[model samples]
Target chain A: MSRLSIRSFSSSPIASKVGYSTVQPVHHLIPIKKQTLGKRFPELNIPKDDIRSPQYKPKDVYQDRVNEYYQNVLKSDLLLHYYEHDSEAVTGNKARSWGEFSPYAVYRRDRKPKGLSRATRDIKPVTPRNIPELTGISINLYNKAALEESWINISARLQLAQITNVKPKVVYNKSNVLPWKVRQGKECGCKVELEGRDMTRFLSTLVELVLPRIRTFKGIKDSSGDKSGNITFGLSPEEIKFFPEIENFQELFPNLFGFHLTFKTNAGTDERARTLLTSLGLPFYKEVKNVQ
Target chain B: MWKSGLRKYSAAASSTASAGNSTSISSTLLLTRNPVITADVSKFEAQYYKYQNELWKRLMWTFPSWFYYRKGTISEQAFRELNPGPVFNNPNIEFPRGRPVVVHQRDRRFKQELKLPKTYKEVSQEKKEGGETAAEEEGAKEDNLSRQIVPNSRITKADESKDLASLERQLSRTLYLIIQENSKWTLPTFKEEQVAQGDDTKDSSVTPLHTLAEQGLYKIGGNSINYFNVSNTPCHVHKSESTREYFIKSHILSGRFVPQSESIKFLWLTKEELGEYLEKDYYKEIEHLLSDI
Candidate 1:
């Protein structure tokens, strides 16, 4: 509740004429409340990780059929167990006390092959149904000038549609902010979501014709993931000309604007997303070393 | 046959004598019995004879007397008045001198009845009644087909999984050629002319293979000669909603791209860029061919 200071409205001449009954206090509810364990028993509240079994295996098992025979037959441990000390060696080898058993046997056993983690070992093969694919690409334009002048919003919408080859939806200001000059429900920006063939086509233009041609464009930084398989980047106002649609009718748009491009993918993890994206032909700057 | 014919001649003479004295009912009966005199006498004779030759035949077959004997042509207005009505009058109901005062409502059901069949019983009786063997056979055929389909589906699944595994290995070092159309970047594909089957091989220029080679060179440009060795068959195949596309792989024997078309630009994007740029299915088709190399 606000401090019960002198009511500013009561002092006004209009308030005296209208009477106190005309003015009513508006009730505002708080958005969030602190959590307490409600009426449930404390012991019954189990964590999700606790419920999951320790052993992990994907439903779609990726068994190496081609190397199945070799895998079953040839295990490095079976062929040779290089122990560190004399006591650690096998009975026959230890009795012989031969130095050539393994000159490099400094440790108990050599490490497994590079990508042989438990997670990778138990991976399920990807099917056509579960294949990681591009969902859609969204172009978002935040027209800061629109807040000051309303007419700019209309031109921004037209600009986005012309460049993206689809009609854009007008984004409105959600809240009233006097300082920023934004009014509630006023059109402030425009966005377009491209899917299916259009998404692919737009992506093709950005990756090939537009992004690479930009002088300052040095591939997407490794840190640019949304942590949810979606990668987003921005282009400058000048880069808009690289789009063939925009390039063809350069006279139409005298004042070009830049926009944010978001690539949505079905890969569950950022790593899978990165892999899926890498295959599509986008370059990642920092991940180059890691990928190699 | 001769005796009966003579008896009939004597009877006709007596019937003439009787008709001369007083017109008798016997003569009227004879008129009805004679095939030429009555309209349905031939139909009655057919019931007994049942054979073509046995049935009495008219010596001269002509149109009805009313047609030629009428005052005008058959369809003329006056001809309708001249045409004869039924020979016997109905004793039960007398024809009114003028239009009858009583008006009866015409039954609409009669017209509707004409559209329906007279009897529906015979139709169902004619339907062939067979055994369940056909149904059993059909079920067995379906079972066989389903059985055949099961293994095919499994084989395809296995093949896809195997393909995925091999794709991962191949992805590390694949070189992609992206061709630009309008503003969009897509995989570089040579559009081959769809040739009709079994055409003459004399014109090597028109063959699909040759056409692909020519277009491939044009799209690839003359600059890739140093490092790239373009292959004969495509490593990845994609089909858009409109056209069939294939992604061909070549070893990067050594050089960079030299743009060929003014509007149709070209770019050498990494696998990740290709994945992001191309259509989902298009990228997926060549996804296996991509790797970190």
Candidate 2:
């Protein structure tokens, strides 16, 4: 058990706390000892050759159907593969319904086309169960200077996000999600382990969850730990029951969800990232804001 | 219908360079994660291999540990020790056993090594310390170029001239023109206007599916289906009333993205919304199951 040192490949040091992404078998399996993300991507700052810029040429109008055919028939590799089955009752239930929200493909396409592999047909779609839920939380700053000092906040969240089983997806959007209609209850559809299930439970759970966890735990600086300070963990609805607020909203949100808690400190960077993290009630970090 | 078309394009691409190497260039021919090809691939096998390798090359960005991260089972005791917390309400939910979370792995390293470029800091430091630009760097280490590559999203691009509304309009119009040319949709405004007084019957000519496809907003009989993929399998059901109707129904019914067929029949769905559905496949069972009662 050697300490994981996360340093950028650059001659300049890239230090961050260590963490792992846990997925069910057939996906993310961590080794006994893990290397830091920075080490894995030493070339983070470098530019590469053959980075083809997409030439987005508008195809012929009549080609729309052909394009549509490609989109539907040719599924993207990013699609979470799932095995779908149902009793006709479930099928009938499904039949009775129309449009769905998440873009999970019914039939998972192969990573590559036929011919390249010995048996392309042998490849099966991963069952819905196989897909891991990831939770993302973004912290945007009202102040430009705060946002610019990224490592201060990014490192903190990264450490918390990496505690163990929990997987974190981070983004820097002025707003947390796509500029579309927000969902009703759940935080995210990410296939990652979460802290609390909802807003209320999150507060209590954080004290419980992170308190026991120790790693020479310090806030932004080594001297100032979260002894009297606050740190945020973006939460989902299913995790809310663990919150102290659950008693009030129990009936409303039976399914506990995770909440986004912003760590507040009088520290230079705390106030900014905290304000941003706390406002994120649900676990959302994919959306990058369109600010000037 | 698309098979011949794709094969044709692949063949054309095959002709440009040595068929051996051409496949390496346009390698990311659209595909799913399984990386399995299903169609006839005898003629373009080289191209297919290039596509496969290319896809693996790209995925390295998102999940670096895809290759070489061995998954193992953590015993219940080990699991508890690692996650000394309360049990989840869902009993079936079991966490992974062996691997602690490590973000980067061999594959990601491979990619990093593939796309390295000198940073301004590096250039500046070198200049201060006595050095030259990329040409000098290039002459010394060509392979090092791919070492520390960062994706575009990480780099802030200053260009966003297209506003949301404008982008939306452009997208919608793009969809409109596409549907018109591909489908048997006939526009009457150009054919004959009332003011032209040419022919009332001719001006009225329209594809039957136009009404359904044109509107683009339909609530699944019970769900909100974002998109619909028209299957032209028994021949790409392009143009013709029944095909259009079938295409609409295909979006509503059968297959992985099959939505609640009930509400989708006449659900209030819009064209732009449908474009999203077309762009991405919706996972029905898992996501929909979490819906609020």
Candidate 3:
């Protein structure tokens, strides 16, 4: 907010060169709203995470067992497991840049990376510093029935909040489809992004209490993941009932909602992310394809 | 990085270097029993957590009783009976300290406390009802989910008696398996059988470091140990003039490590405890590999 001092950039050579008129470019990378840029609003100036700020919330309320296990045990084990002697970082195929001083190449985007349409992340050898750890978990509940009855999404949101202990944000439809009777901006679902203690708590509950109770759960499919360290798997409404929060209160939650859980990690690849998750007690099974 | 330096002196290269005087290659099992319970925190940490937990509870929203316990239901009546409503703020009464700001049956200033009706009657309650036989019958139904959850004590019988050989001794620490051979306590190290030199047909007999460790473990421990090998690769290597010991990292998942031979005495101990038993210089070389927890 007002903590950042405003400086005149008109005098600088770079600013002068890019200047179209008398007005100078803003020096700040992030544009501050005019209403929040004054000393009168002292509360706005304080960071949201600071104790003095109104938005401050205590996170580490107790010793997180799941996170502690990862730190003390899984970390070193993973580092040693992934260790490779004389292994070098395998750089990803990056987008090719046009030759310098080419008139046609000016203001043009670079060509797509080799083989892959998009650039993939470089595979670095695992070390003590860069050992993969669960960063966050994003649970998204898509209520297709809400497309017709918007109020139905309320139950989904409430269901998510009850299980996660965090209020979910309502997700809206982006496009209209006449065939499906879907309209743009319709409240179709809800999502909650969990981190820190809440994330670990959810992870422990899922692994220890819920997953084992599920009858048909072989394991998470080996193929599930975004290839970029985020592994996503969906729980059926029947499977979701295994959660202790909903199990004892089946009468209260008459209509249960299923959700997709995406485990976000800094492992950089799906394979490593899967390994990290497996080490944390969530099992994975190889998906067998039927041969005709 | 040290692994790379040791890679040059691998068993394959070293065996070929000095055909006559080949250095003995051995596999050292770095078997560990991971902490079953959360690590014990310091006084400062415990206090900080308690303070934060209290703050969190104070800031928490009132539990939605209406949602869980619908009005007019038998369960709702039981819940109401268990958790009586807080003191109401009457405008007619004069306030001395402060008027209680009651909202949703909770005082806004204080942390809300609620109790649900117990699924099973307590043993003392049953005794008051003159049902001595019922209390004895309830003791047999320990696995009943309706019974109140009582967590097991963190300190096991092994800990109380200071039995280092038991896996349950230290529930909150990483325990390593060390054996006593020739009256010297050290990590379980197994040496490869020296094959005859210049035997071209028996080249395939050379076992991988991890395989050697597994074979050695079953040989001494009677194959009862159900362990998970972290990887095929060796985690660490200890170099000596006469022998090269490759550390094969593994975790004992279940089962007991029974000593097949009476001469070999083994103990599962924590990092600090191992330092006392192991040779000072030998422990110092591999201290970084052990987990502090």
Candidate 4:
């Protein structure tokens, strides 16, 4: 290997000055092609000048952005069309996201529970037959808290993505607290989105299988506030698949899947958020009962 | 019709080819510079239909459709194109009217700035004089033939299959059609690659990581699996497919996974009740099924 130069992140690290406080402008992503990709993937034979060029023109970036937005929105809708019948996110048959995966499900790690307890589960994780996850591992989510008792669920929803062999998406909705308005500014809205295709092969085993085992649990109330209950979340595109309800969707619809975790809160304050989640019979974190 | 990015990408590509000492393929077939003006759906659908139909006929009749049988791969591709995502286009999406503001962060791209790394595949003066001995050429004639596996990395169910001919041919045809419709066509260019003889790659055969890196299959995530060696056995952070690969490789490199004994194997759960199942070395013997349908 004398001729080949190898660099390791552990040894020589190029630290990112940007913190993960808010979203980072994806600035520019140079596809870090595999070394042999020189021999293997001729498709990436992008012109050096193009790649080496400082940055795309503003108009070019703008055009690309417009195309990407429409596609992302439609893609999310098509994926989440199934939740329409069950969720209240639809208006005149339209779906949306508020902040769906974070509060009760994610920080709590209850998206995919590893074990099944007759005493604890209402909808035990089935054989994972219909909705094949990319991860070979599957968790049974029959209750709202299958994996652990902690709140502020920030688990890798992808842990179960690879096991079931379905396309995986990393969901990051913070909470599922619903809002006061029916169509507009509802903080309780839950969100959904598609993560990525690159993680298909080398996806982490925990993400592909184990973590979901920790997250699976029960869901929201059947009659907390809805005539035909629906919630919204302000979700980015990556967090949609973590929701268990996507599979029940059969047909393709627009804006169906992209959303975030928002929940219907009877109380706007932290204590009220707990009381609200409690009333819904859904799980919620106790420490940050003050967080919206 | 459908403008092509191939040439535009190629023209910009040519500038980088100057970085190395190799015969330039930029002057080859990739010679169109037409900006892929994504037109209104009408023209897009027209050209897309033609390309899709032609591609469908060629691929379906001659090639295996099993990999892309989602109803004429080109058609699906066209459909997606005619309907590209909005996030790529919508710069202000984060600021939807009356919405909470989320911050945008930037990651310092891995700034290795490749401190003048030496080339692995250096051409011998004699080889260069012998002049471009067609790279195992004629191999392309077997249009239906799958790309030969390089045999460098271990093959698994998840890893991609190597089908060079199919990829080149498909790309070429699509590119050609794109060029025919575009007013400008420029071939894509890239920095000349560094290739070294096997002689240069042998200094560190003692370690599996070193060996794989020499093979060039080693990357940020490449690992050796089911091979016997020392460099192959480093513990990974997680146990997914990628992790298992590293684990297996590290073990093999360390002589833990014996190729002769069939000691290590991957199990696809035949059932979803794995949550209840006890952990056993079923790494080789268990088959799990999807817990949900």
TM-score for each candidate, following the candidate numbering: 0.31, 0.19, 0.87, 0.16
Q: Could you tell me the lDDT of residue A91 within candidate 2?
A: 12
Share of real interface contacts recovered by each model? 0.00, 0.00, 0.53, 0.00
lDDT of each: 0.46, 0.28, 0.81, 0.26
Ranking by lDDT: 3, 1, 2, 4
- Please give, for residues B1-293, the per-residue lDDT of candidate 3 as tens digits: 11233333234444555456657888899999999999999999999999989877766655667666777889879899899998799899998979986656777667788885543456447565875685665775676766555578999999999998998988999999999979999899988776677652344765677788899999999878999999777888898887788888999999989999889999999999889999899989999998888
Using DockQ, give the best candidate's number: 3
- The number of the candidate with the highest lDDT is 3
Go through the candidates in order and give the clash count of each: 29, 112, 1, 179
Better of 1 and 4 by lDDT: 1
Lowest-scoring 10 consecutive residues by lDDT in candidate 1 chain A? A76-85
What DockQ, between 0 and 1, does each candidate earn? 0.00, 0.01, 0.26, 0.01
Q: How should the candidates be ordered by DockQ, best one leading?
A: 3, 2, 4, 1
- Model 3 clash pairs? B174-B293
Q: How accurate is candidate 4 locally (lDDT)?
A: 0.26
lDDT of 1 by residue, A1-292 (tens): 3333322212223212311121322111122122543555443344423423221111212222212211221121111111111222111111222244677765445444444322221222233344456677888998888888877776677678656756688789999889889899888888999875456667667778888888977787888876557888888789888888778757656667788988897654456566666656688787455553
- As a whole number from 0 to 100, the lDDT of residue A38 in candidate 3 is 92
